[model samples]
Target chain A: MKKFINQADDFIPEMLAGIYLAHPDALRCVNDDPHCLARVGATPGKVAIVTGGGSGHLPLFLGYVGEGMLDGCAVGDVFQSPSPEQILAVTQAVDTGAGVLYLYGNYNGDIFNFDMAAEMAEMESDIRTRTVVAADDSAGAAPSGEGNASARRGVAGIFFVYKCAGAAAANGGCLDTVARVAQKAGDRVRTLGVALSPCIVPRIGKPGFQIGDDEMEIGMGIHGESGIRRGPTLPARQIADEMMSWLLADSPCQSGDEVAVLINGLGATPLEELYLMYRHVHHTLSQSGIRVFRVWVGEFATAMEMAGMSISLMPVDEELKALLAREANTPMFRQFSA
Target chain B: MKKFINQADDFIPEMLAGIYLAHPDALRCVNDDPHCLARVGATPGKVAIVTGGGSGHLPLFLGYVGEGMLDGCAVGDVFQSPSPEQILAVTQAVDTGAGVLYLYGNYNGDIFNFDMAAEMAEMESDIRTRTVVAADDSAGAAPSGEGNASARRGVAGIFFVYKCAGAAAANGGCLDTVARVAQKAGDRVRTLGVALSPCIVPRIGKPGFQIGDDEMEIGMGIHGESGIRRGPTLPARQIADEMMSWLLADSPCQSGDEVAVLINGLGATPLEELYLMYRHVHHTLSQSGIRVFRVWVGEFATAMEMAGMSISLMPVDEELKALLAREANTPMFRQFSA
Candidate 1:
């Protein structure tokens, strides 16, 4: 049970304080609330894109706050949803003259908390709010996307959703348009992850289950959600092939379809291994004649020190491609569209 | 010895293969030498910047090559220097009509190999080259910078040096000017690192050194170089305060001086913790009345999976500040000045 933390209870506040110190030019905490952060001077006339969820997943929820991305984020403790009060504070802090667009993963805690905040915003303050759930973990849904994507857990593909929606909002697109594009990107993007190790929540302990040295679980979620199966550890290429099989099964990415590929390292997985995994993913996608519009490989979202990786693909139409290519820079996640 | 690598012997090549796959847009292997990678189509008339060092420190030597950054990087085995031949290949691959500039940490192996490569380039290929040795680790040298800073080890401060020199060269500075800026940057930056946990090199085990559970080493190098001393573990703020004391003692940053701060995580440390460390660093600098021109918090350099962090500060004159604020984007590090 070795870890690097001060008082386990002081984790969230100390971490938020650190973010503010490091990114003063781009970010700031809201009204002395460490858990609620907003971009420095979000565009006054644009739709405010706000999101929140658990902590522990670096570059997610918080890291995407900046121009061309989120306007504000409500941060929770590790893997725990932000309280409704935290969400409401962030929602009020970043709302410009325009209404607010809420973006977050489709977890139950997040849904409940955000729903509560949205109701409060409507009743208490005359603010209009909309939400587009990011349920992009395709394997968490049915083998096919008939109706199960609604039930699937959200994972790293939320980055893509944020980018698409944020860019549209930054360009003065209305809240409905931003939400529509976000929903489209969220619907098109499919993700599948595999874990070779389990991690702990410092406040809690190690995840309840154990994984052996030679074993791995496919379709693992960031918070150690139940995967479909567990078996002997496969090589990088096989892992890519197996994940791609499920990814393609849920949503058929046909020949000539363009996609943006993201190979996200889940915590302890090395960047080198993630790229090795990407090599196979690229080859497999090419074999199926799917055109790679672009590729992103790095630690985008993580679960503490879980030694695993997730491959997410967002099939792009013209509008999605243009939005994905827009410029954005936060502390952790960044892209230069030019 | 839990690591996410495939074959033990194929480590370097496989890792490079993954890098190429993930970053074909920014980098390409030179002369089919997996150990040598160069930015694709470097500016044809600008003085080229090239660097190399051991592998395992991902996003370091190789990941820094792209627009407004290094033109090339020669890679080595995990924590081992690349061959002189590999170095020469990268030097020649990125050489524009303008001469080449070599940049690297002041490691023994790196100095020897890069020196040999520069000699070969001059003698055989008629290419002129200059070198900048970054020796920024304050604790790795004598207590004072009067004469001993020349012998200090290079760690995360090397990133600042690269940013300064690369931006200078990208601004069309001549080879000599670029070399001058790089040397000035190398001299002005000071860094101090502490390791709470030691990491292993996959080939061999933990370099035959052990620190007790309650103990930590201050001023540890990336290769676990001998630090100033060992003592009981401290909290994050205290670690920042202690490291700042050594950093300021070596290179006094007076009030009204502006500086760039980087809180680098040695592998296995979480970003949340790194940000927390930056919080204390910013507070200490503010107390000193030193302005933070910029702040970078994340893994710039690492000893694979070592649970510790280092703080680097470079007193930025007007020139160094502009160079740092210049735009740059490789796979891992990026900033847009707009």
Candidate 2:
């Protein structure tokens, strides 16, 4: 395993320290706990949005903490959920007179801890909190007709949830409104990913799964979870078309519908290839008579050094579109009006 | 080799088409040639800055062509210099009454072609052009005291050149002033890189170079060029200390200097590892009494999917710092004020 690391046990702390050092003006640790990070200053009387998830996905949970984005994040170890104490710490630090909202991916571990954190906040500090979990992975266990989003696992499409919900909170929306927006965005977005290679967790020092060099897994989860299909690596256009078909079929959109597209690199995939995928995705969308309002092509979320890409489509209304276009200044994402 | 590609020959054109498709509002093709890309609407009366180099380095040559940055870019094939005609096309399209400035990395093929393009622009269109070649790799052929920077290879530190020089042009500086600022930034920046593995060029379906599984090459160039040293991979801190020693030794920074740091991933390294490296870089600089003004940690320049990173340092003065802080909205980068 060729990695730039020191002691494996110190990985999370060291990375957190590095982030704080690099962007000291934009982010800070909460309650003297490095695992609980928040923006430098929390705005009073504004709904505070907090998220928490396992590590390995940069720009996902913690990287969104900044102005016009997430207010705080409770970081966890690799593929492991953060403790309830850490989540509560972030919630308390970010909450002002307004209530706190726990927005994160829908994982059993994360959900349990966040719920505990919410209960702890209510019992200990009398701070009200709400939850809006993102479960936008179209290829997850949930089927579209079942309407059981809680059975799905959130992936890169969670970015849309963060963008819409964070913007609502930044716009001084009430906590209930922010949670509603988060859930709406979460419901509207769908994601599908392909994995060419697996990433090694620091402590493990070996890849979690193995595949042939010329093979790939479609609909792979971020943490090397078994994908829906496995086959020989296909051409860029074919891969993009197949992924788009799955996403579009699962998403609720029609002819004349407008949406946003996110072509995300799952770590080692180059931006050049990401854009190539975007070309086909755009072409596919146009053929279906769908209008693309805005597009983002880069590594918004990653799975360590895994090699692959994920396509996310979010059908947007005027409300969601405005929030998506709002200026976001974060460690990992920045958006300005065109 | 595992790669997401169709025909190897279609790599550059397809990638260019994808870029134009994804960012139609911010960028446009020049003279019907996709290889020549320019900002959608160039700001007339402002000195135009045009840069070009081989493909594969996204955000390096074309990714910088947006607001507050380069006015145009002449894209070449993967690792192959673009034709002089392509460069001329970009120059002619972006240049207004104010002459153009040609800024790019110092390479034999690129310098020869860009110089020829300048002559063509002057003779055919009467659009005057000045040239500034970035040569900031501290580990290249040039020795620190040799007074021959031309022997050095331009690596990730060239980003400082684009950021500073692009800001000068955007601020309505004349061609001479912008060229001077570009040269000054090129002189102040120093870069060094390490490679744990090699990348495969698309046309050539094999790794460009090879190394043992446990070995790493320090001071390696972006294109798998031979480095200053090779040995077993060391811990993150030790690697940081060693690379910092080499960079600081070759640079002109003193104890009380203020500098901007860029920890660039050479493709496959994870953000977690990049921050671990940054933590050590920051600690080492602080211990030496060198204040870090700003830092950027991401894949600024990459070598396809090679697994490694590069460290770039530019000792900044008031002038350079102001330019670095200017707002830039590009396809790949966006910066806003605090």
Candidate 3:
């Protein structure tokens, strides 16, 4: 309930305005549709990568737009999908000779909105478009051997997808190639989150879910979806082992596999704790004979002020590793070399 | 406290170990002293910049040590100053004969410890050293013109000081010039914070400070120090106005002055909320006829999971602006251009 906001209804627009102010050189809003943010001076011939989702996840849908990253983003209110029209705005603004790519998480609302936008783009403007929905949250899907990985909900793993796909696009890859890389990221990556506390929406002024103070839920959704297992919070060593086991059980990373690691902090988790968890994650991966190509640990993605963390492991092929290492200059994320 | 830590006492060193693993390319630790971290191959002849403070205010003391920023940092336990020995270790590791600049906040413990380290370095190693303690927290200082600004505690404004001073050092500025610029940054910048809730240290397992559910404290310190006032929580707009007024009154930026602005989260504040607050901060700064040269909005310094934020305004001269605009590649901070 204690949030730094004015009128609750104005949260999304005000936040976008604030973002525009903070990262003026990196992003600009569409003329009539402020919800759409496009990179300043997007390359004329490069494929456009646009993403859209709820507003609460910082550095996700919009903050990803910049040089060597997404071409544009359509923003929505907190935990709410953007309108189809808003997604179309981004598509129209960033589209050049190359086709547009709609990249986003696999939530129901996002799926429907982005689908409509793709339809609208193809029908109205003759601008070819593709969709690469990320479903990397292993807990949201079925048992690894039985359930469809494409049906899982996306979490922090989507960032790696964005990195590779955006880099592919920036590298002047064909639309099909970009889509393929993105799809590959989706297939190779998996995430499992453990939550210690629920988050409050600025508008709602209350936590989205209720749980005991000493409890934690494994595989909790970003917006308070029920996690698979709930129990007393365990020590760092035990929790790190459990989460890593769940992730590897689903994706099954093995010896000598070149992989990228992300230890993502859910809003309130400290960087120090994230590193502590990463220490165990590093050990766990090393024990499995996984060779980490690159490691990122921070708040790459978040669920409002939720208190928890998510571990993401992306098995990296040579091509994927190259793309992941590509230059990225955004307000929140910046990588130097490809 | 429900924190992702194994044992409370193992927090600091374990966190540092995790950081070392996460960023092996950019940073390295002192072998004999794990408390000290230095940028790998810091420019040989460039003046070395070393910053340190208590732990917990992450991305502050250690995360800032990378290319084009601080050359090294001495880390301490949560809310406790680094020992003089630790500071001396970093100083000796990074000293390249251009002399060393010891930059840190003006907290009592940090001041005392860093002072001891500087003396030790001079007497033992014959390393020329200068100290530039940041006292930019307006809330912890005076009643505007009546009190000594140097008596204030350094809060988030210290980040701006670090950015400028470190950049100056990286740009081949002499030790005295770097120290002067740091001192100038410390003099011009001012910060005022508003806290809605208190934070609990994982080791303490209890709230450090207390307030009623609906109440708030203005100008609260990051370490739960007494603030200027306490009352019911106010809307973002009113709070922004009040904080801007206090900062401007203390430092008194002019109409045509170029300023660097930082909207720093105290912890547990979501990025959306931070941006929402920045909207008002931008408006207030714009209306004041002060043009923003650059703006940083995120958790630069935090007080565990405290639900609050601080606003820092640092007037920038031409030299300061150039230094602030210099490229910095750090773990948490990366700047592309001016």
Candidate 4:
């Protein structure tokens, strides 16, 4: 497909420059590498929070880096993880005197690069580092790997962990404390997404996958991985039930547990339909005796205009709730009550 | 062309039911009419803000209604305005002890219906009402209707007004004051949008307009209205200039005017490209002596994967700046002052 880019290789650099210009008050590019985008006036003594991913997810990586959320973000090309060098650059730039914490989705390439970068930071700089990978998608894991690393896959639910972890780090928590809170939030969270159609990456010009007009793939990965099953499109109620069943099965919380519900539209799904799905999700959660402390329903994490929805549930205790409620001033995340 | 909806007629009601169920704490349906959605704790006496449009724009009308934002929203069918009766029902339900203020995009059908509803409420009830139409699209106005009524087409910039007006109303501003602020925001605001491709309504199953792969339309309206001109697809920088020129002309403020800039992706544009465009927009604004106080870049107002972007400039004054700086806690908007 045709794109407006001048050259494929320059896409990331040019985009970062643009972001810096538009949001000079809120963000600035690292003076050295230019690829590392950091929040303006990020605290120096706090455990810095760094995240990076492909560039297509606008607010996901860049928009989240501001006042109360991410300290810095390294953006790669569309739908592709940044290189190890880029990740390390962002890590080094955001590392305050207290060290740095790495937070990102559980994509395979991202994990490899971020892990390598963490090791490099520890050896090269005096910076201590911790990693909390978001593995919230329950649809990708088998029942046996319910809570295991092998079965966990990160989806849109990463935003919640970013909120909780960023607040923890911003509040003067050490690397260990911030990582623990993020891990706890990740463990309690479960997400399942479905896509009606595949997204067309501008570089590729065509969809990454082919979905029939009459069908939708459940349990699909964010990168359009093959889902558990492809079946006739079901009603919103049925879809909500199917996804919620998998999420609840993977979650350790009981019916009496308090949680936050995020009914995210996978790009093309309208808000009206999202609310419909949220209705079903709320009813299902109510039937299970879960008390939803908060509800976030929108395109928090989107895949272009891919039509579908994902449901993420995060069990919240007093501490997690407090972190989630803390005042956050990021472009995409804002919760004023701690 | 297929859609998840069961029937064209059932679309709105089904979606409303789902929203109420999902956000029982944040939103509620009118006792009798399910189509009217209101915030849960929105009592009378507070200035009520109501906005609505077609159903396709997800977070725009419905997702925007929550804490610190809209008091209520009346959702129409896909890409269609709500009936006069529907608008009246929501206005009556939302009018607490104070009067109601109607805020929405500038579209003929919406204006006609909302005006009728406001008149009905004045005649039948003790509530007073005022209206502020978000006519920010600089491309759609005919040369004759230049000022308040002309040069008015509401696209994505409405989100900014919602935040500013909602904050004012939520702070207990009287209906007149709320209307004044909203109108001021609308007046200072100017938006220009262009589309690479037209959006297909779920029920329509075909694109609203046609464009070649190598061509783009400038100054297009959200609902397939004609733009300024159709030309070969241009680079990001050139496209940014085309959009900025219109916005600058539409604004009454001159160079040195501090304004809030919103670089909105029309659903399909990638974040990477958005930043690229943002870069050009920032440089152009600086060259013109405009001081950008705040810049928000994202898919705030989308047109169902239509490949385009819109730029909105709202000249800021003390009151407008304060309202913009005030905390907004909604599903879609969250701003934290550093």
Candidate 5:
């Protein structure tokens, strides 16, 4: 709950200014509105990619903007979506002569504002805009209701979409192509999370939710949404199996299905534990007839200092594999072009 | 104390197997040796860059091995150094006709063991090795004692050396040149840390240290070494000031000393707070006549779930600037070539 800020209202602006100052060569804020952070340059002919949501997930929306990733990001306060006007400004700023692509998480506020901004850019700026909403968090929606596609919330799996879409855009794909690739990546990905405790918002000065000292909630949302179940804290292997079962059920992966696995730590989870969880997750996936072609086990996306983790699986094809394998020269992600 | 491992002893080997299965193209482990992880078909004639440390810090020693960063990493148990024999095996495995450069942290165990391995390599294999220990933690050393040059302890600033040396070596710098560049980066850098709570090592099943609920310790080592002082928790801005003041005092910069600033979270600090800390740290640096040319704020090096952060500064010159800006295509770090 203890935070370092001059004023609660000025926190986002102050943070953006600092990010710009720190990464001047790699990032810049919109001329007046500090909330709109964008990669500097006229990315002409390339489908400009813009993603934004809350502010707590570093390297997610902002750290991902660079040569081969997002072109701009509109930031909100911690766990809050940017205003519609902020999104509009970022969309306009990043729109080169080529059309722009709006890629963001599927949080309610973000979905509403980004959609409004897309319409605004088309109407006023004569810039065509398309969108790809990342809906990878299976825990956000009822599994039997929509089959991983309906009303699903975006979580850490947004990073995979960014990489695939950015590579497509960088390869001179049109806005539609870039959007399609991102959408495909989003569709193929699914995530399930569990939380050991709730996070404290800096301004709120208290935990967002409560968990018993020896309890953990399975299939929890990033914002502490009620999970499918709560149980006594179990060993990490059992927890990994429990999460992997949900992800593997109804998965396109069968025996011999190639997939990418991401064992994401929700802020407070240590890397050591993440690797341990990854060990079990890999074992489970292998036993379930899936070959993990690529894996990223780290804190790609986070939920404050919440002590939990999520597992995301993305079925990969040759094109998806090639795009995923493309070189990305971002501050956070790097890959060599094969 | 709940962990994912079936047994504490199996943690490292199991994690290595999982990493190898996931990134077979990007990484591989030595035959029958789980401690040594190396890149597959790594380029020859380039100065082989090696880094290793405890297993808890993700993306530090292991996540950095790829095309343009470290060639190999020897991972030890949580917060412990790999044995000299493990270090020697990795060194030999990564050495491809070219001599190797050992770039590791400055912990006493690591230094002594790696030094012994370097000597063993000299006598056994025809491999010549140079060393560049990351001595960047300013708080660990007294200014008047051995000076920052000798007494500093390595922390997150090791990433900067990984970047510079990786670039230099990738650009065909000789072993000595790569070591010199890494050493220069190590020399110009300084870090200071603070912890709100001690991290609990999973295997140890207990907190590393104790602190009052409302108290924090500044200048704490990465492995929970006692800090310079412990006091009641203050706002993030004051904590940022305290950390920056000590770091800047150790390496007083002039008006135009371009530097790279890293606001590293010690595991449990949220990105929201880290960004807030970054805001204050940037402002403090500006007021101190230092200009930050590059900035990275993230959980680069963590100490389990310790609620703390460390700020690192590296003064940049033309050569250092070029090396810093050089393209590094690693799994965790990337920058445009200078």
Candidate 6:
């Protein structure tokens, strides 16, 4: 797998340099550390939102930093967690008198780092902070009541968490409310992905896993973690139907429920194919009497250049719908509405 | 080479079904022909802009149909031109009292079809029409003084033409003015692309072209058209510099000129890699003493799931800048400004 990179060690910094250069008007680094990136215009009195994780997932952690979204991000190298110091720096930089909320995925390293950063922020800056780790990958955990939900790996559904929590904060919610909103969204949204091909980490220089040419791994994690099963490649409709069924089985959505559908390309899948999956998902939802109120069909979260996609559904209520409709202006993602 | 598709013949219709299902509010079909997609709300007196070409390039022709962009699009099968009847239907559906403009890529099949469609519109519907073919792929033609510019392929730079022409039409420009703006934009923009891997057409189920594991092809077209040359892949910085220099040598841009840059992913390249390329592009532009006015880096136009990217530069005067900054609200693209 040939990559457009100079050196393995420079991948993250160079990518960060490129991001800062391309979006100077909207994003900035703290203390010249490219890993500690924050939005340019921070509202001082509003609660700040900060997210962090590995770097392979574009538009996930860093891309969410902007108006009506997150205020800062602590970026790590490909599939590696950021240092506690880096997280602390970002937290301190974005924190206002109103406090900061730490929102990120449910990864052990990220959890450990953010927890340490929160402690450091409290001790050193005297700032109050809250944490909400998204655990939305239905494949990684038992159904809602069967097992621990907090253990699931976060995936594309994390976008909803950011949107809901960010909207709450932008609407002048207190730190507790923002955290509560984030947690609520995280708990409600469910995602499951299928992998047609694996992706290579820049430093690794090879694919993390392999799939047969005529096979796909269903319910795979973004990092190429083992899925529920690997089987012969299926048609787009069948894939969507199976994924949607799994998601529905794990989620709280029932007849007459409304959902926000997100058909996210994992990395290398074409937008056309994602739309095909969306078509079938919509069909299944309508048959189940589930109404799709809003839809986002593109690469919202990606795993480098992996060839596959993930389907995420967030059953939305009046509050979630309003929050999801709120305006968010970021480099990779944007939404405009009430 | 696996694809997320059903029967090969159903590829286009299924994808169109997905698009229609997902965005019924913003787009609709003409006479129930899935190939003839148009914006739902057509301003009665506004000069309508219509574009069409082969399918597989999402957000190119169909994705541009909406407010402040294009009024309608005649979609086709993968890498195949739409029929003249399809184009005629779109033109008649979108054309109000104001005349319509035919804006599309400069391809042999497309030219023949659209020209036929224009003739039909004049003879049957009595709708006035003009044409502007985008020939912005600098790699496909000689520099300004050397050869006929109409022979070049229209790549991702067509986005600029759409923005300028669409803005002109939205701002109440007559058919002639919209056509003039489209022609002006088509003339000023230049693009060059590199392909790292071949893409498989759905019916073919095999790559149209192939490259070595560690090689890349520069100056490739969107539909597997042979590129200028193939060679071992270089670092991102070197690639950016080389591509930028080629564009500069062939373009009208000179020192102190302001330009908008678009670093577009072919399909499979990751966003992180695109930024690395963007970072070096900014450096190269700065070194050339050219001013960067605006930048858009993403998958604007794609070639299925081909792996690589392209860079586009458009020198802008006050007129072009204002037109480029105007608001556009399409399904895949939205610009809110000016």
Ranking by DockQ: 2, 3, 6, 5, 1, 4
lDDT of 5 by residue, B4-97 (tens): 5567677777767766666667777785787888877767688899888888777678888976688999889888999888888888999977
Off by over 4 Å in 4: A2-4, A42-45, A143-148, A203-205, B2-4, B42-46, B66-69, B96-98, B142-151, B170-173
Name the runs in model 5 displaced over 4 angstroms: A2-6, A140-148, B2-4, B143-151
Q: Residue A12 CA error for candidate 5 (Å)?
A: 2.1
Write candidate 4's Cα lDDT for A1-338 as tens digits.
Answer: 43546655676678778777766677777756666778878576888999988766656777788766889887777788887788787877777778788899888899999988888888888678888888888875754345466566788889889888988988889888999999999888888888888876766768999988889988887778777778988866677788888888877768899998888777656556676677777888899999888887766777765777788999899998888888877655556664
Candidate 6 C-alpha lDDT tens digits along A1-338:
67788998898899999999899999999988999999998787999999999998897789989888999999999998999999999988888889999998988999999999999999999999999989888887544323467657989999999999999999999999999999889889999999999999888888899789899988888999877778999888888888888889888889999999899998889999988888899999999999998999999889989999999999999999999999878888876673
True contacts kept of 6: 0.69
lDDT of 5 by residue, A1-338 (tens): 54455566776777777777666767777858878888888667788998899877766778788877889888888889998788888888888878888898888899899988888888898989888898887765555335446567788888889989999999999888998999899888888888997887667778998899889998787878778788899877788888887777745567778997788888888776777777788888778878888888777888878888888999999989998888776656655675
Model 2 residue A274 CA deviation in Å = 0.1
Give the Cα error of residue B109 in candidate 2, in Å.
0.2
* TM-score of predicted structure 4: 0.89
Which DockQ value does candidate 6 get?
A: 0.78
Candidate 1 or 6, higher DockQ? 6
Better of 3 and 6 by DockQ: 3
In candidate 2, what are the lDDT values of residues B261-306, reduced to their tens digit?
9999999899889999999999999998899999999989998898
Ranking by TM-score: 2, 6, 3, 1, 5, 4
| Runs with alpha carbons beyond 4 Å of true place in candidate 2 | A141-147, B141-147
Candidates in order: C-alpha RMSD to true structure = 2.5, 1.6, 1.6, 3.3, 2.7, 1.7
Each model's TM-score, in the order given?
A: 0.94, 0.98, 0.98, 0.89, 0.92, 0.98
Candidate 3 docks at the CAPRI level of medium
Q: How is the predicted docking of candidate 6 categorized under the CAPRI scheme?
A: medium
Model 4 reproduced share of reference interface contacts: 0.55
Per-model fnat list:
0.42, 0.74, 0.75, 0.55, 0.60, 0.69
